[model samples]
Target chain A: MTTSLKKFRCAALSVVKHDYVARGMAAHPRFELVVVADDPGVPDWIHQRNQKFADEFKIPYVRDVERALKEFHVDVAIVSPEAERHVDLSVRSAKLGLHVVQDKPLTPSRAEADRLLSEIEKSGVRFMMWNRNGLPAVQHAQAEVAAGRIGRPRSVHIDFYFAKDAGPPRGARKTDEQQCGWLEHQIAAHVDGSDGGLGSKPMGELMIEGIYPLAYLRMLTGAEVRRVYAQTASAFHQLYVDHQVDDLAAVSLELDGGLTATIAVGRIGAASHPSGGEIKLHLLGDAGALVIAEGKPDVGVYYRGQPERESRQRRIAAENDFILADNFAQAIDSGGPTMLDARASHAIFCTVEAALESSRTGKAVTVRTF
Target chain B: MTSFFVHTADEAPWRDAARRLHQSRLVAAAGEAHAEVFDGALLTKPPAIRAALEAGRHVLVAAEPCLPRVELDSLQRAAKQRSLLFALFNPDRFLASRQLLRKQIDGPLGSLELLRSHRWENHIAPAPLGLSGSLVGEIEQAAWFYGRPVRSVFAMQPAGLNAVQVQLCFGPGMATIDYCDALQGTTLTGYRSLSLIGSRGSAQVDDHTNTQLAYVGGDGPTGLTVGEGVRHLAAMLDDFASAIAEQRDFSSTVTDALHTLDVVAALQKSLKTHEPVTLEPAEAVR
Candidate 1:
């Protein structure tokens, strides 16, 4: 069932600009690109939308909940504020009965996180973040593995990176691009590598970036991770980072089903090694094994099976963010869970966060999340 | 059960150790005798931290308060596995004749829940009296900071290793922005003063001062260098952690660290003097 006449009037901020390769995804397709400017002025939607499909922009300061319902009259509201303010807007959007497509790492601290999540849950609005856009190769690999192209899964290793802005913060798209790092900038979604100053890179390298491929691994193998022992290092601390964050990181993670993943990641540092975003997802099962490196920026794979030689070449036709955006829209248009949701992001966040903590303190940090 | 090597002597003191650990299992931990001194090393070397987890066991430690800081931190992390590998000083219960922890166990991040759940059933408490509050705090901080699994080292009193040299590591490793080059030395050596590799590694000179670059000439990087300063601050945490635990005397480690602070101070001098020379001729402190 396709949403035929589902016309949604959308408005976003400049932050949505210059954030990703396919920058204006939210305004395409089903939603009519309505309001965009320096500051998203708050105009009461119900009061201002003289026509039902009319698009408009309002100053953020002037808009209030009542005004939004009375003047602006949009079906839902999208808030892509700064790093610290995402929670408030997401919560407010829910209270206003607007479906929200807020960005990643929704909140910096957990104390208020429950408050926000609880509010949205109660509001009954289909609340979601912009963490979609599955790396094309990652989607392909999951398909191949599920088709039994690879044998039993023993271990998995993954790598993914790009100019810090390469991957969307965790797995979402938003007009909001917050500064990354500082251990507190929850929305700062820079894919950290081995060079990531210290803790930041671990989450960026292993979890955020790795989540795409790792999620694929999880999808392929119906096994869950039980115990994890990890170690991290700040070896790349010497170099200066220009983008206000680290440039390299490495994580050694072991999953529940006897799978050991050794991931190496790096970003640009004053003395950082020259390496673009590269992800090597290695799946080791009982029968045979397969390795997929998103041929991005290079795409290559090596499979061990009936063939004497194992290799393949695939070109990345434009980025697949549209799929991610459309899927989220459709998920909202139809009340279904988006492929990349809070629960999955939280798992990746907690995993990477633990990895960073482990590497920094030389101890395998136990995540205390239920 | 997973087996563990712990120091449980009937004479082990439990009440005093209980004061340090926040958990209340110390005084009550007596009946749970894990192993006697005849049990050998507090921790057997094999089944590494990783293997023990694979086999479904734990590596629990109840050693002297004088145990090396690195080993303690590592043990806490190893406990995060399926196995229970943790340690902490416990309060000696009953009379000192039969050793036992008086109250609850201390873990890396907080309580011994992580290790307890994994079954590292040994109770370590009431280690040496001089254990620093910083040791507890930093271990706790790192435990919380990294979410590592940890427990208390249950024993009657402090062990012997607490001099001051190992204390150098209490500082942040050499990654300061200013001391740039000088920072390398900390990494070359586990810590600047931890230079004594083995009994025969180098000069016969021993003691915390001589080895640590705490002399007149050895300064700069160690002086107020960012990394060195960080290490120095890390050392400060020792005072803080030990104070909270009430286990350590507080002088030797802190005073020595301050004295050695001259190492970094003098090095900065050498850089300005543009000439290389021994910081203090190595005779004054010894």
Candidate 2:
């Protein structure tokens, strides 16, 4: 007997070009990149990058989602938009009977997330979230714990620290319409804007960057967070005077089965390595412990000069982005489980949202199970 | 010469440490041709401890004190009043790696941000001294490194005494001390590691098969030899003899032990309340 490949005609929708995903899908054996949908509201520079990405992938570019859906038969939509826009784009794709692969922070709030999740369930489309850190090491750790190597995990501690400059770039110009976007609107809505500095460009750092670590914790431990107590501060980032979005956040979670996990995240000083950050996850159990240190590039070059010089380390293994795209493709073709799905993504968002609420009320908040 | 009376029992954890002190010529052994100390019978009896205290002999406790709080308190008061040294032997504090760790912390690792210490024993022994007695050494090391008492403690013990995870907040930085005795028999690495992260640099000392201090920043990837067969008990004995001869404060004292007990007490209380326990200066000292 012989098996045939199930072709997935893919379309990528983005405000900024996610060329890695575009390139990854184009390179997959079963995925054919048919369309690139660029939002017209994005800056011209972004559009230029989108055109370049489309040209590199040899795919036709569409200016809007509706046009992409009408012009091509897209089997799946790879949506990488601003956090607030994920729901709208994902819902539209699902409604058009297209499977969805959306970026992190599935939505800014739970209500929008629920709406997107409902649409996907109703449309019966395969939905996967891009969680690149669900790597082999994490899966192996989980397997070991399941195999009784660690013997019933008792607690987990994870620390994630990144450089301030490592954040997404704030473009040259800011418009009034842009200020109404999720990132800016969140600052004005949740925080007092007395200094009038530019709000965090892509919402709070916890929502933007914290999701990956949380997802990794969930993936490793397989423990659902039951409650969260958190403290957040805008300790640094003097650049954002108006936004009270937290640059530093510490969240303590009570997981199911009496396991406790604490996640500490901050945008601080530059790391010595090129990864621009450091991650340490320590999971303790009755039998043994698992310690993982990520963000260390495989090879580093050091030089002695007037001021000195060094290149950030690069990993020798295949990039996580490529693996993530492959996983999405394989899940769609095999009708198997992806590393992360809508429910897991929603749980991450809820945990982050609970952390935000805990910071506000100075108390622990129970995560809403949906 | 300061006379020393070694108290030990059969299978005592610190018997070898006490023997090292006697062998190092740091003190004059004063009982039973040193046969009783070697046989490990004298220390298990309270009468011997009382007789040693009365004779003004500096006593070395070769095991976690199984005495009650009142008796331990009385012993400490008598030792202080008599000006006789009473020290609990914690060998890890005397390791060459510990000295190098101190040097790195005091010299190159600037403005400590966090410290993590992990110690996993091969057996799940009951806390004969107290619930925190087994970890008092780790707590003392943290205090020694930070140069401050633990101001607050939060602990989680999911499996009761089998495992304990403690988060200690000091004046300068924070620390996590995790102890587990689930893994039995000898394994690679022995699962003993200490990590110090600071603003200027970071250092990790893994004291398993080979004791080495690997430090980065200031001077990158500097590996220092933590002398093989370097006797930590001997180093501690030297400190004890010098302190006694000069009539000065020793490296670790009864007061230090009390502080650890207080922190452990607070940690135990916090474990029940599920809230952080704060330690006041007066209470810590008292």
Candidate 3:
């Protein structure tokens, strides 16, 4: 086919010094890294190290995230800022006619999330969510289902675990309006504040406390969260990930086919393994079932066998092949989809939205539960 | 709830069986041949089976039951609704069976009333679901006269060395691959997945999937397997074919082509539910 759009520059909003989402984009095989942030918050040693890495890699380093986009004339801006600033950045990117690969927890609110999604669509830019980690067997199961290997799918089950980084630098804490605008700044406060002598924070923040998990659920289901019930570790007091976030939750999802998916997730004291992220999904069909015990091939699944449950002893396959940088490369080469497509990413954000709603009320919430 | 419909090609042994069956007048019929349809299932007509399916609907058919699990499951869901399993049988015999009863021909429409009065409605439904089953052992070699074992592939578990015979079955794929092609006739299938305990059952002889059985140490070297081996293949083939023609005869009580799938689903359910399931009474024809 003809070249749809060839060779476009891209800007990242998160400060360059932190090897976070920007790092993901840089690693993609397709896209060429164009520009990144320059910040004083970056330690002298870290900045020197990273700047050299960026320079050696032939990527530009700019002081302000927005300035980098305006000067380079990139076709897209990866909205990697803290949850609070996503809306403004997304709107700005859409206005610039720049396609956006937005980070999840799209926005703290549904309306804003919808508006961003609508604008991106109207701007004629592709949108997608950014979920990393080979994630074990999820993709393979999806492919198998599409291939009709398994009959009509009826149920889906997911299990997940995550740890927090309490001592993050710069905009790490969910406080600055720029860093975590729509989300409340209650990580350490509410967690520590809710200790025996302390009381829970009266102010509710979606980003730090509720948004991520809710958005994630919505994204993975790839459907409107019709209804959901979630119970978080209500009285979480221990500090594990530098921040005191409710580390675990049990959530149930009922989809269109009268099919139900139950996800068990939460944080625990020191991990027994080295998985920073994980998702275990079991897909049930008429004849048999395909269980994705590991999210990616790089991940491993082992358990102290349950009584009646069979010993899960299979090896997970590899899917760590998706590099974030390729989003730009794909956007440039095939004129097809990039990992950073806009609406799909919005969907993932919407999941976090519903999850947050369910957690706060101690009741099941619909995707549009607003 | 499993059923098997045996078909014959003007063969004497089967003809004798039919003639003897008619002569005995016990569950017998009088005509050029006797045809019978049966419900043959254990579960309450599951919703999946009810939407469509009929018995004695086809003739001259074949069945291939070795579908990948997904297709198999889908078919089960669909057939389970009607509380029907499937096997093929001859259309002519079935249609003939519905005609005037030779012995009780006192009045014209007497047979209809008698059959209807007996709830033979299942006999008139469209043909049931059908599939092909591959057969490995040479059917001809195992005939009464030839009686060869080494030639019978899937043949194992020697019943008796006195008269000495063997026949083993692999997967249903080899049983009906070539004949299972999509043909003009409707097809019904019977798959008996029985676990006989006391007399002649072996664990290796799982009925639902294809299997082998040996009649070891019989009174006189077990004339059983050799009694009518060649026709057995034809009879099995005819059952699948007849269902495709919608002409299965509803004259016998034992398993037939129409009830094969029915029986299998039931037995499977038994295995699943840990309870014995039974088929419902056949409905009266409309």
Residue B156, candidate 3: Cα error in Å is 49
Task: State the lDDT of candidate 2 residue by residue for B193-280, as single tens digits.
Answer: 7777554445667543244566767855433434435466556666666766766654254556567667778878877976667787
Candidate 3 residue lDDT tens string, A41-93: 63454355446656766787666656677788777666654445566777777
What's the lDDT for residue A29 in model 3?
A: 42
- Cα lDDT of candidate 3 equals 0.38
lDDT per residue for candidate 3 within B1-286, as digits (tens), equals 1122323233354444333231211122312222232222211132322222333211122222222334345534444444344332222222222221222222321211000000001012222232112211112111101111111121111111101011111111011000111211112321111110111101111111232344677632221111112333333434443443454442221123223344334434532442324444332111
Q: Each candidate's DockQ score against the native complex?
A: 0.01, 0.15, 0.01
| Residue-level lDDT tens digits of model 1 in A321-344 | 676667667777777876655544
- Over all chains combined, what TM-score does candidate 2 have? 0.75
- The local lDDT score (0 to 100) that residue A47 gets in candidate 3 is 52
- Highest-TM-score candidate: 2
The clash numbers for all candidates, in the given order, read 138, 1, 114
Over all chains combined, what TM-score does candidate 1 have? 0.42
For each prediction in turn, the share of the native Cα contacts (below 8 Å between chains A and B) that it retains comes to 0.00, 0.08, 0.00
